[model samples]
Target: MRQTRRAIALFLLVCSILVPLPVGARQAAANPFAELGLPELAVTITDTAIEGAPAERTAGRYVLAVTNDSTAGAPPVVSAGVGFLQPPEGMTAADLIAFFATMATGPDGGASPVASPGAAAEMEGPPPWYYEVPLAGGIYALPGETAYTVLDLAAGEWVLWAEDPTAPRPPVAITVTGEAPANQPVPEADVTITMTEMAFALDQPLAAGPQIIALTNEGQQPHFLVLATVPDGTTVDDVLQLSMTFMDPSATPPPNLSFEQMQDIANTADLSAGITNWFSVDLESGSYLLVCFVPDQETGIPHAMLGMIDVVTVP
Candidate 1:
């Protein structure tokens, strides 16, 4: 299984660099939120707890502007999101915690958490409704980097937390009011990217500057978008090889080419299948990799391996 998984990862990595997702029916030009403006929420990420975060927000489409205020050096990356679970009938917090404690240390006393990517049932009860912004390249920020993502929340109670467990902040209790407020105007999308089963579609080239990426996922599984700037002189091929080394450590490393990660300008939390979310990002003229890292359920391979990658040039 491991060998097959590694090969699948490598193949998908190569295909992501070469192929583009198919285009689907284009969305209407009129921006729905342009007239009905949605709320803009501010979230501050501190080394300790997420400060200035609210316990409740109106359910609907909203923008989250995350600012990082960790001590100067590269702070540990933190993922921000709302996790909602429909606990089993009559289950209390203590019951759920005890169930999860078992998950923390399963029947055989192994340390593996019961739930993992693509394995939702391993969770104690019904999987939690997760609306999360995946950390860019798995890191929240560099020394002083800040970014934002848009999320669509349904009316419910959600538990909010940074990705790190050791962080000082206690889990935040958020109640997403079931009532969606009056629609407000949202800026027109500068670029729209559509996602499906391991593929993406873009109608036109992206232009440099602050742009909104309207992400529409049509697949049955969740997906997220990461726009990482490719440095000068580095080809997508080089990037793929570097990625392969990490996927399969036994594989030989690429000579002379150091695997330095590029900066990500924009990203989004995992969008449940058949959902659409839009986020704003600032882009300079350059080559970028639009990639998704969601692992496939059956194969345990990432969507990127299944060809969910593309080279985007912003002129």
Candidate 2:
């Protein structure tokens, strides 16, 4: 039968490209952890993959295989935190809990190996908002394993609530609508962007799809917000000399990462005093900048040359 109808249409196009996303089809964004690519505290889990639905905001290393079952085997207490982010029909829930206070967090379950600099929940509470780059080992988990360690976010509309905090009624929130570019965060006209001190004020424009760059570190120190994109115009001193040029495997550009390139990407994160960070991308406009560098050794200056830099547009 024509090779069984071309092998049943290539097995339904490889099950529609591997599949993974059913829990309501996912798309209620504004900061659903940048569609789940992560940022806004943390929530990574991997083991093989088979829990069920919910996970589509780009699905990067945001890991979440989680399938312990745990009913008679008992362990059903897998909670995660950070709130707000599920509004848009008219908006207003305190502006989506002030965009989930930049990544609030509560359970923390794991990952807290030392480095609690001062604790307000460890260096500037990501819970009522506050940060200057302090989310290193953000509430890790690993026991039977299902990973994700560091997180960085500040976009907006946030929400990363996984429950079992003794579970009774509500918990599995997960409303991280971040990443803007395609249609550019369609907030109608109220599109805002402000990061403070370290930088970012960029008035408006950005709604093509996936751009979510929202930071909020009230300032005091420790900050981070990387984000990358080159080619068009490319200047800001060549984007700070390509963000300190890193890629020298014994020179002569032996492996690849050199043309003086830099792209680890961090659109928003590493906050401290007042905490908040978020970085998303889906851009195509051109000449963008949001730098930081984080230096401060008493005053070595590096908050992107003390300005933090900002010149976004994204159409």
Best prediction by lDDT? 1
Candidate 2 per-residue lDDT, tens place, 56-156, comes to 34312232222222222122222122222233444443554333332232236432122211211112212222222223112212123222222333343
| Model 1 misplaced stretches (Cα beyond 4 Å) | 1-37, 72-143, 163-171, 232-236, 255-257
| RMSD per model, one decimal | 9.5, 21.8
What TM-score, computed on C-alpha atoms, does each candidate reach? 0.67, 0.23
Worst 10 residues of 1 by lDDT: 130-139
Among the numbered candidates, top TM-score falls to 1
**Candidate 2 C-alpha error for residue 281, in Å:** 2.0
Whole-model lDDT values for every prediction: 0.52, 0.35
Clashes of each: 15, 55
